[model samples]
Target: MKTWSSIILAGGMSRRMGSSKALLEINVQTMVELLVEVLTPFSRKIIIVSNEKDYEYISSLFQQALHVQIVTDDPLYQGEGPLAGIYTGMKELQDSWYFVCACDMVKLHPNYLVGLQERLHTEIVTKRQQYDAFIPYSEGRVQPLAGLYSQQKETIKKLLDQNKHRITEWLTHMNYYRIEPSEWQGWTPISDVFFNMNKPEDYLQICRERGK
Candidate 1:
């Protein structure tokens, strides 16, 4: 098993949701909590990168789980976007690769992540291989929310120190991997594994899909 910590990036403003999407409910459980449940099977430790008062509510729910920790970005880094959240999470972990994820990706399959963990053995992988990050692309777009990153304190700090805020811009500076849809054949049961819950309408679609 790959010894890694999973970091859920819940610090985004969620302008589209008009509220903290991380706190959204699906079958009475908050999205973040549900993500934690699925990640427990794969990670040694879990951290939440969040903002706003809602974290208190979320924290109360996970207080018993010793492996879960929550960290909010400093004022300077806060509101800077997902890159800042990713940087904050990587710095928090001492000696493990980070499976960085976003709270919005509600349909993320655990097997999909397991597949990526198995891919960790490739020669293309490295702790300091100059490949600063890894991401998966699907349907013609790079899915930044689902990624695996090394716990490089310097790289994380440099990211926070830089002017680039958008993840795509920063991705251009790093060497990374793009797992095509064709690569996941017998692993995950779900296709479009990166399908995220961006809007309420999408949630309704998931509800419909699940119903069928």
Candidate 2:
């Protein structure tokens, strides 16, 4: 029930995939299009961060939606990875909370956000400590791209200025609430919900699995 904006990181080089993952089509919808569709209901604004070349094309895709904004990574932090993407998105929108996702994720589970919101509300009711981020831990790793973040642009900027661009590394400096398997497994299996395509074969595998 908190004010939420959505940020989709779409600027990866996609070197392994051999093309822009954001532009990849599933059935008829591009990855970004699918993400936008799923996120619209929960977001007041949706920001897609791509590189310079993809900016115009992505912008054209969402011209009719006033709440969606397509942007290029900031000139200073361009190509710096997911941390830069997160900073660019948080900088673009002033919303208090942001649901950040990677464009490569094929089947993002909306229930994750719904459950996280409920947990946050419970914390408020019980007067428990809160955190700057609500991240998921799956397969023994933290999924920062699938996390919800508080406005931490300054923290991100400081880290990037110091030449630290890894998102997992940046998380160490923030107070975060980690959602483990026990907390999220009831909604959906983490593997299915957070399956990200890193190569052509991964895409093919996902398509085959989904009967696409």
Candidate 3:
């Protein structure tokens, strides 16, 4: 019911995967393409933040199929990490709420994301100033990328200005609502939804799952 924008952080070095994970495929579609498809219905705008070199390659794949805006990290914050990607996206888009995701996530659950948006909107209507972010917590770790951020431009900029680019560190200073894994039990298994491909083994695992 709440309209928001989405930012896919595909700028990772992927050193562990030894290749661009965004380009990795599931059923012949790149990871970025699949993520864009999953997010298109929920987002008013979709932004893909990637490195300059990979921008062209990624664009070539989706420029025609989807109406997405692909951008490189701000020159000022190049190579700063996912926090910089979030800052760049929030600064570029006018949306008050943003759903940030990592490109490595192969099985994104739309229901889970929609549920987060619902929770965020409910809080906005009831306790507006209580939270700036709605993130998920699973296996005792907060999933920053798979979260929604609100009015984050200035706050994120402050962190970037201070040279503090860690997302977890930045979260400590904001009023954030954490959605526990228990909250998503009915929609899908937490492990399947949050599984991110960081290495060859992880990718292979997803491939094997798909074959089942």
Best by lDDT: 2
Q: All candidates' TM-scores?
A: 0.88, 0.94, 0.93
- The numbered model that scores best in TM-score is 2
Off by over 4 Å in 1: 122-132
Sort by TM-score, best first.
2, 3, 1
Cα error of candidate 2 at position 119, Å: 2.0
State candidate 1's TM-score: 0.88
Candidate 3 minimal-lDDT segment of 10 residues: 183-192
Indicate the residue-level lDDT of 108 in model 3.
Answer: 90
lDDT of 1: 0.76
Error of 3 at 69 (Å): 0.6
Task: Tell me the tens digit of each residue's lDDT in model 2 across 81-186.
Answer: 9899999999988888899999999888777667777776676688678788888888879988888899999999999999998887788888898899788877
Model 3: lDDT of residue 195: 76
How many pairs collide in each candidate, listed in order? 0, 0, 0
Q: Which sections of candidate 3 miss by over 4 Å?
A: none
